[model samples]
Target: MNTATIDTSPIRILRRPEVEKRIGLGRSTIYLHMQQGTFPKPIRLGSGGAAAVGWLEHEIDAWLHEQVSKSRVSSTRA
Candidate 1:
């Protein structure tokens, strides 16, 4: 018998565009949620950089899971 395993280490750091595509959210909406403290805050990839560029794949995955749980709870209540 053979089995498959998954690697769970935090690897990829997705940029804003990739994150928007993955989460189906607009640029403004993403920033809005972040301001509300309901989303993962991006990390600084470099020092003294004008453009913000950094994100943890794990954090995004966790946010997705939270959204799924919220949906499930709302549906159960309805």
Candidate 2:
């Protein structure tokens, strides 16, 4: 017998405001980074002609960690 598979991972989505709070960036900067492909793009949270969008919590966390890592690495080379 075959059964339907389900994803059990804990997924937390953050809205634009929360993202800004966590990353300490303004809305325009976030959009700018997204346009430049330097930031994680938000995924549509609403369907059926809705425009709501949010970012995956883990992606934002990873981006923050990467920024810190890059800053440290760059400083060490000086």
TM-scores, in order shown? 0.83, 0.85
Clashes of each: 0, 0
Per-residue alpha-carbon lDDT of candidate 2 for residues 1-78, written as tens digits (9 for 90 to 100):
779889899999999999999999999999999999999999998786778999999999999999999999999999
User: What stretches of model 1 exceed 4 Å from their correct place?
Assistant: 1-10, 49-51
Candidate 1, clashing residue pairs? none
Clash total of candidate 2: 0
Q: lDDT per residue, candidate 1, 1-78, as tens digits? A: 658888767588999999999999988999999999999999887778586776799899999999999999999999
**For model 1, where is the 10-residue window of minimal lDDT?**
46-55
lDDT of each: 0.90, 0.96
